[model samples]
Target: MSQTRSADRNETGPDRGVLPQRLAGLGAALMVLMPLAMWLANRSAPLTLGLAAALLLAAAAAAGSSREVAARLRRLLATPPGLALAAFLGWALLSILWSHDKAASLRAWGELALPIVFALALAASGRFRPRPTWLRALAFAILLACLLVMVELASGLSQRAALGLGKLMSFVFNRPAITALVLAAPTIHGLWSLPEGRRFDRILAIALALAVAACALRSESASARLGVAVCALCWGLAALWPRLTLTAAGCAFVVAMAMAPVLGIAARDGLPSLILNRFAVMTGQARIDIWLSFGEVARARPLAGAGFGTSATMHRNPVVAEVAPEHRLLLGAGHPHDMPLQAWAETGAVGAGLLVLAGLLLLARLRRLPAREMAPRLALFAAAFAISVVGHGAWQGWWIAVLGAGILWFGPGAARPQGEDHG
Candidate 1:
């Protein structure tokens, strides 16, 4: 009877191992599918929620019933950095509820929730430890999507600008620039992880770079371009001055902001009529006016914001009269084109503080880990996230949640350990 019981245990245990593998596979497939869903839905809430649910289930399943899963989750929650981030997010949500435009605030807050939840879920599952094959699969998906977009854009050229796809192709076919930024980080990390001097590796790197460049160039969206540029600059700074990178980045940001108006105007009215036409009266070009108006609204109701999705009210405010007539049609503006400002305007200072704290906590958590273990990937993710914001404004909740989950699941670095080297 003892032997029979032991035999039974062996069979069942093997089956259990299969479950984790199956779960991991599902998680990976969902990772690819989520972006596709976003493309199809054009970043709508229903699609985002569906993807988020799928990711959570996949992560949970991958974790199985292992004692290690529970232990790791406890450790993660107990970590001061993680808790601080959660607290900040909670504050932000509370602030959102206090907004005058409660419905709008709720809508805006809903967008932020997705990424946070996704990240937490991934971290909790402990199944995101890097796997080369998984990384390769992700890279392939991104490349395929990019290629399809390129083909579509090229095909439309002969049909003239009338049939030209441009942003539509990006939004519907490939990941939007914001999503691209997130996806790009992992692709770069995967590239770096590959054995050096391989022809295929070089080819892959070039292909990814080209795809990224193409997406940026064709986007016609200013913030998206800015996001990619920022990401590149971050990579350079991180390589040169890991310690002073943040300070330098801050300085650079100030300088950029100071110069934006001058350069922006030139871009808006430049001789290259096509480019200028794209920039003129664009959503990004009007961000300054919108941001300024948003500040005033927030000031008027400091404790609670205008409420989520209340940017429309601010847009229709008398302030709209001050903007260029061409830009006056922005009454339906959904956000202030800045994350912190949007938070404050929708939720209040308390909510904004929480969002800020959460971001800082994420950065801090990344800092505590060995650079060699996580820096490359973190750098990529940071670059992508930053770039996306420049072009697309702040990400919605679902994107953030899924991205966070991906990082947590995969953050510890590749399963194969390597010696620490700061450089």
Candidate 2:
């Protein structure tokens, strides 16, 4: 009977460890190549690669331990971050009922949900933790991509002007903002991980961080510069008081929302001339104008909104038309360039609120981690925040892929052995 029971136990055990391991290995390979995927293919390619990896991760988890995967999924759904994301996605889907462009809204919803699903897979798959080797590979890939950009800049890859900035791009479709954003997170991670690394790693980290900063400056992407600055501030705050970091971040968020409209108006009223000149002034004014217009759209439909992806169609708001007539055509076709405004304008107050809730929960999670982990996470968060405040279209496929990849690549690596070097 003992032998019979033992045989039964062996028979009923989860999967053969080999299968899950292979799946996981395959997933890791895809994740490591995500940077190159983004550079060589369309924006969707990176996300496609990430989604494939995530699905494989899920498969690996299920194969390794079905019951464990189920339980983890349940636990994730109950968590604040999960709940918030679920709510936001649900609200977005429901908005399609009233959306004028059903097809477009559905596409937007799918795009928004894809990243969430990918993130969920990462968080739930306990065995699929980010390996340091994979992280290093991604960093090297980014460095190579940056080198290509530098070459392009030197050789004049294109005669087509870059948003009036004359900044160069890789011969490929890469942009300064996207490149800088990608580099910012890992560079911050390198600095944060320096104390715990070997002497060689310390030198490498310093060199990488410096190179990333130089790349950002040379790229001359205002958004990337802002992201870098915000990351620096976050790192400083993390070093000072870990507990207070969340409070200050929350405060800053609130202050920014409160001041967005006012600042936009001020910029239109000649404040830019007093503070900045030339390109800076023009870009600042453009952001301000778009932000104010989005505010108008949100105010027009405080409850249900005009509907997801309907920002383009709903730009006839009298306030936006009057306040920024020159922007009317652009407003009819472009995003507001601000995440909160994008949510509020397209998905209504409920969607925006859920987004805020997700952010707060993320901050809460960060608060529980050590300084070394906290610093890099905070840096990445800062970069995402800054970029969102002045970004491309809300539902831009490539932009979504970039943001998702950044989070996936940098987020899970925060975990370390108990005695590892910390910030």
Candidate 3:
């Protein structure tokens, strides 16, 4: 009977190992798939990832880790940073009540809400240690994604044309390029964090970093290029004096959110011809013009904003006539091309304040991490923040999802050790 019981235990042991290892594999695959999805799925990638995350959570529960996961998630949600993010989301939803277009507001709210929810869900579910295999997979994804972008640029988007994806492929690579940039930041530290990393992982890490920088340089996305620049600056500063960078970053974010509309005023004076014409960058002049116009919209309704999701259509608002003709002419560009500016234009002071508070709280929380970990996260945040300030609309679903994906890549708990009893 003792031998019978021993045999039974051995049989069950392999069964237990299978579930956890597979779960870890799934988590890693999701990370890789998320970046690749940026190319094919476009704006819908966020929703795709959110769905995947939900499925992951469901599977985790069914694997007999439900109670432990739930308890951990509860503690996280109850923390100051978690509560702050919830409050910010609540305020954003409330702002939709005042949106000029209710239907659009609701749709936009779903885009923002879904990603935030799933990102938190994943964080509460597992622990992602930087294993050699995971690092290689992460690096390979970056290389593959960047190479595709390079190929498209070289071939004049022949693949997109072949697919009947339309003729206007000028900025087609923007989404994927930016996605690669975000992933690359975390990948940098991830590769570095791999203990006892093999020669392949080391070579892959170097190659991956070079590929990301090259993609950012070669891709048409101005934001991706700027991300590389911003990331380097932030990464260096954070590595040297993490606390200083975090404090400055937190303060800068608050100020930007608090004063989004008028930032252009400080930025737009006597510099159009000097910077816009001479710089020869694609979006330089256009960005300044957009900033000037959207600043008026935000200035028009500072306290309450035009309402959530209004920046995309703020030009149609009667307020355009009130701003200067030069500034007003560019309002049709669909967005401020700036994140903090978008927040101020849509959610007004109330929403912006909550966002600022959440940012500060999050930065404050990072203080608890050792400098090694905190530096990389700070670099990621700073880079993303820079992109938001200069490039993407703050609330765009894909961009937000990409940011969520960045956290999964950089933050703890995106994966777990194998051979665990629970998934």
Top TM-score hit: 3
From the highest lDDT down, the ranking of the candidates is: 3, 2, 1
User: What are the clashing pairs of model 3?
Assistant: 127-413, 127-415, 128-415
The candidate that achieves the highest lDDT relative to the unseen native structure:
3
Q: Residue 108 lDDT in model 2?
A: 78
lDDT of each: 0.52, 0.62, 0.73
Give one digit per residue, the lDDT tens place, for model 2 in 192-290. 454445565556565556666666666646666667678777777877876677578777776655454344454567564655455564366666767
RMSD of each: 7.4, 6.7, 5.3
Q: What TM-score does prediction 2 earn?
A: 0.81
- What's model 3's overall lDDT? 0.73
lDDT string for model 3 (1-423, tens) is 699657543422233445655665576577777666677656756765666576556556655666766776786677666787788678778877777777888888887888877777776665333355665677787788888878878888888778876544757778888888888877878777766555655677778778888988887777888888878887789889988887888888777776678877777775656667755454676677788888888888888877788777776766677777777767777888888888888877877777777777777767767777787777788788888888866777888888887877764532221232222
Candidate 2 Cα outliers beyond 4 Å, as residue runs: 1-19, 45-48, 51-55, 58-63, 158-197, 258-263, 280-282, 316-327, 410-423
Better of 1 and 2 by TM-score: 2
The backbone clash count of each candidate, in order, is: 33, 1, 3
